[model samples]
Target: AYLSPGVSEHQVLDASYLASLLENSTSSYDYEENESDLNSLPCPQDFSLNFDRAFLPALYSLLFLLGLLGNGAVAAVLLSQRAALSSTDTFLLHLAVADALLVLTLPLWAVDAAIQWIFGSSLCKVAGALFNINFYAGALLLACISFDRYLSIVHATQLYRRGLRAHVALTCIAVWGLCLLFALPDFIFLSASYDQRLNATHCQYNFPQVGRTALRVLQLVAGFLLPLLVMTYCYARILAVLLVSRGQRRFRAMRLVVVVVVAFAVCWTPYHLVVLVDILMDMGALARNCGRESHVDVAKSVTSGMGYMHCCLNPLLYAFVGVKFREQMWMLLMRLGGSDQRGLQRQASSSRRDSSWSETTEASYLGL
Candidate 1:
């Protein structure tokens, strides 16, 4: 190589040094470019897709059958006795209604999970709103039932004593109104939209990120946490009162209490916890990547199905467990089946004596 006359040995760079520097710079640039490309590429997220297709449809279909049958039976029994409904009866009736409404929407979700959202946008919004509305109403009514039990037992105040059926009806109206308010967002934002990645349309929330976060937070607090807190407090007080009392009713009440608490926790807590994790991930409070997101997706699906199954357990836990309810249900079934009128009358007369004794017990609401 030729050097300029003014260039000194110190000022001139050796060929090897220049070559090494150029190589280093090129490698650094290439690494940076590669990093940028990786960041820009969409991450693979098929971890839960196959699992969801196989799992969600079956879970949803089973829930639909169980919930519909259970809630429908409760509704029939409650409606048959509507003229003489106690405050507890009124709450149970509405709870059954809420659960039924929620269950009716499950078929749509099942079809969506198995294939795609072919129901179109209007039906999607309506079904989504109904599902959410009943979800809130059911939880609130459970809280109301707990409170009713507290008043009837702990305070020794008979809700039906003062012609409070009107009050109970009004409370149910208020619950429905509040649930409607909570679900308004779903009506406005949910739609069946196409997903290119999945090659299907999905019925889902369509909102800004901030709006989604806010809506989810509201749901978590109002729908689940608030009701859970209310039930916890009211039942805790009721349990304290029941503990000091003496009777067979006490033992039965203790069992009823355990069943109620365990059933609620098992069905609901996991779903809400997974939802909380998702909310945290959205807010950047938790580390999130494709793998973690896929796991969360699977968890949400499984847990939400578990939550849906809660509707099936409600009728068993709240109604059939009660002796009075069982009698009423038996009467309803006999009538529906065209059983012998004379036999029905004899059974009714017998039940009246048994019911008189049951009515005096604190757990009469449970029909225990």
Candidate 2:
């Protein structure tokens, strides 16, 4: 269960009836007489609502465009491959699929942000569930990629040796299954409801207080901390091995791993930190006032947008960074233009030679 911008979730659940009464109050003189009694009412945040109206739609639309094009191209390229996939390729393919699915939900959110949840209750749950499923799936798939890289490079082993195809299929199935489990709350609790204060409909979860707190904690742990730990440990060990070895190719691969970790942290850290604060406030660990609520609400809105930008960055970091993938993309483009087979064969040979830094290290680029 979560909150959208506008009226704070804490305020919405606790004070909506009071807000409705105040909205229905007609006499200014009666309000003046009872002004002291209404002093404790949650303050209206015109700025947050106005910001959502102007800012969220534009940002969401931009994210949708960039994420769609990048992830779509990634999916197309990976799918075009005729040979069997390595473990890293399998992980990357699923990551692209998850990101593409997540991006598809942005247009609906864009509309919800600009206007209201006019799609009604059923679509609300479906969209919200899809969003949650893919968000968690992307994070888990990234961890899987890092773990697969760690095994191939540092341990000098594959994630599976026997029945490689079966293992890859099982891994993907497990990832999606876990994502669905994590997002079960959304499917069960998310619904489109009218926010009388902002005079707009919002699609948000309606979990009990304990459930909301638990879900937020789950998000912080599973979505951010676990992935961070796995990626950091895997890459740190990979870098250690690379540093001991002597080659410019190894150095370049080392730099790539560092960029991936840093990019993930930069894109996701602030949003999770904001979520932490939200949890604290909800649990009464932090003082909850309208001023703080307003600021956190706005901060969450902005940081979550920044987090979504990573969907656009993943293709660049994971796919385009690979020499083999780039060569494949070029061959794909050339083939579409009726290029000769001999030229394609020559380019493929050159790419294979150039991409071979080390068997294990090159696999990090999905070059295997």
Candidate 3:
């Protein structure tokens, strides 16, 4: 067993074997290191700050400014003619108010998305509550507008000849009340919480998982689906009424119905679909992986940004599209800063219209 320290055949074989074993062990270690490094790398669509720091702030800021101006103009035009407003105009006034409130909250959300929730929990709850309120109120107000138009068109002379003013006022109040009620969830559950992953404070929807899911479903159904159905049915009936009449104005009104419906669908559908997908993923129906989840997160942000634009679009699509609203805008501009010629022209036009036209103004203002 005691071998001499010399270069023998057995010693050569033993050294070569040991060298080969060491090489194999080192290769295995390197292979494991490579595997671990590969595993640590993130895939495409990983959640990151790139989306938050740039796109969200810019998008929200633009929306805020545009919404402010558009809604502000609508409110100003309506308020300037406050005493003369018809039931239709009254609903629009409330719609403008709701949009203003909704637009006001955008700066809060914008700042949060850009940096963090610098505003404390109280304001966070307030702002979030306003959003829900405005959302429900806006659509419900549109529904009100639809029904009002329906009543005015189909049974203007008979059904609403008495107590119409009082009835409309009550309906507006009721809409506000119901919107505030639905929005109570925000006040109750919209509290700020620290997200370590995002490494920032967030003022977000943080209800219990079950309640949150149910609430989201309710929002989609009541906030959008029901209103859409009501609007569609109302417009269909309105269209039927128009087909019986023959006027250039009615043709223009027919065009308006198509445009408004298309705009509503475009602005809202994608966002809700994205939200639904996110909910499904949360329920483990879709792939439960970071990449897919991050993609969904990005999509939600995008779609929500799109959704917020609907407030701005409302004035343009629903109100501004009306000839009367445009005329009002011109008159509003004249009141503020237009030339003497425009003012005289408006006055002359007003004088030229027959008294019978005055009775039709309310129905015309509703775009039907």
- lDDT by residue for model 2 (1-368), tens: 36222234644564565676667777654767778757766766766667777888899788888898999888777776635356676778899989999988888887877877889889888888888888898999999888888888889887654346788789889989998998888788888887766667878777678998898888889888999999999999988987787767777877788999999999999999989999988788999887887888788888888888899999998887776777688787888888998989887677555543112444434342
Q: For residues 1-368, could you state the per-residue lDDT of candidate 3 as single tens digits?
A: 00000011112222334445445554345655567544533333324346756677788788889998999988887786665666666778899889888878887777776777888889977888788888888888888777767766765542323346787778888999998888787788766666443456767655455776677787888788998888888778878887787768677767876676777778878878966776686576886554665665566667777778888998887667656666667766876675687665666467335211112233453353
> Which residue pairs does candidate 1 place in steric collision?
322-366, 322-367, 323-367
Q: How many residue pairs clash in each candidate?
A: 3, 0, 0
What TM-score does candidate 3 reach? 0.79
Candidate 3 local accuracy as lDDT? 0.67
Q: Which of the numbered candidates is closest to the native, going by highest lDDT? A: 2
lDDT of each: 0.74, 0.78, 0.67
Q: Every model's Cα RMSD, please?
A: 14.4, 3.1, 15.8
Higher-lDDT candidate of 1 and 3:
1
Where model 2 places Cα greater than 4 Å from the true spot, the runs are 1-11, 20-39, 161-163, 345-368
Which ten contiguous residues of candidate 2 have the minimum total lDDT? 355-364
Model 1 poorest ten-residue lDDT run: 1-10
The estimated TM-scores of all candidates read 0.86, 0.90, 0.79
